[model samples]
Target: MTGKIVVITGAGGGLGRALSRRLASDGDTVVMLGRTLSKLEEVATGIGERAVPIACEITSPDSVRAAFAQIAETFGQIDALINNAGLFQPSTLLEASDELITDAVMTNLAGTAFCARAAIPLLKRGGHIINVTSESVAIPLPFLTIYQASKAGVENFTQMLNLELYDRGIRVSTVRAGTMVGEGMSAKIEPETMMRMFADAGKRGIDMMARGASSYESTVDAFRLILNSPADLYVPSVAFHGLPAGWTDAG
Candidate 1:
């Protein structure tokens, strides 16, 4: 993957920042895209030259377009795109305020698609788009209806584009990741939402830590497997929690 150009959204912190470092270590030119330029710059500083910060608000199509255009002028071309920017506000549909609802829809659904659309023109043959989804859609945890809906939309988009983008020599896939807790990430839930969520999980005997928290390292490996797979092989969507060292057979 040396010299390859990879664009990652929400690269200011959390999973995005960790993933940005992975790409940098692998010798890929990582463009760190996020709403806050200062935060992106902070992360980029640690990564040095390989990671360049780019400000982008994925929810707005204009922001996405201009950002990609700037990337093109600066980098010449993009090899892959990782649409990892999202908002995960846990609340019942009834309890969700207008702002919360809008944030979820815009960031999770519209934002994901908007970035994809903005990148398509710049992407050439063999380009890839990897969308980061969650396991909550399959687990269906309580008080997360809105969050699940947005992720579900991304999953649907990934699946649909997998076939649609094939003719253009592009590949699309989704990582239905399980609960990931790490530096800059909080495992804590809101008081009201936590009570409701726990009550429902108890009834269903749902233990999220059942698989143990997925580490940033394992997730990076999972992504590497997908991104670097043989061009002859067919890579489908995958889900992962924690994978033992040298466990590359996970598909």
Candidate 2:
């Protein structure tokens, strides 16, 4: 209420946790939203009073509405909403189960839409929405058809949402991020699946072992920048990629 109030989804996860900490340190009141209360609280505890943990199952419309209602009551308005919650699993399209496809689409794509719809009423003029997408949508990777498709949908949603919100003075933007590593970051794919994905990527000229990854901490500042940009500056989207291992500047 006193400072900028920001809501970050998936705040229990690595990148989300990092962003929560970084934004709180910048004096914003960060609401950490995720499905797991314990995880959100763990991250919030480290940030002290500036951080608030709220359990939210983004894939559920009722859950999302309830969470935002709570947020509206507590803070009245939010300066920014960071759509960072997502699910990622490696499995061939043909082999992927129905649950996997449903979870992937609902969590990554529909969840984002649900949160945005709920947040619209609470976001005033000059409010910002930062939707996190992945570089995997553009870069080829095996066993990620669902993940890639969902994130691609997010990218498109960001663009169209920006147009819809333009008249309202609420800025919508997308952050297309590359591979990142951070504390508590883990992918729940079987070892064999991972091996197959790696081997397949290698055959396609992409080396997982040699690929570079950014620290989750390194990307948090970019969101801060987006939130603090001048009112006249409208950035529709921004992308970030890590340098490959042993890559050097020649010039």
Q: List clash counts for every candidate, in order.
A: 0, 0
- State each model's C-alpha RMSD to the native: 3.7, 1.7
Per-residue lDDT of model 1, residues 1-251, tens digit only:
35679999988887888899998998998999999999899889999899999999999999999999999898777888999888988888897899999988999989999999888877868888999999888986888899899999999989998888888888998988877766657235778777777787778887543445666655887778888876666577888866444556666
Candidate 2 displacement at residue 55 in angstroms: 0.8
TM-score of each: 0.92, 0.95
How much is 100 displaced in model 1, in angstroms? 1.0
Which stretches of model 2 miss by more than 4 angstroms?
A: 245-251
Instruction: Choose the strongest candidate by TM-score.
Output: 2
Identify the runs in model 1 with alpha carbons over 4 angstroms from their true place.
186-188, 208-211, 242-251
Instruction: State, as a TM-score between 0 and 1, how close model 2 is to the true structure.
Output: 0.95
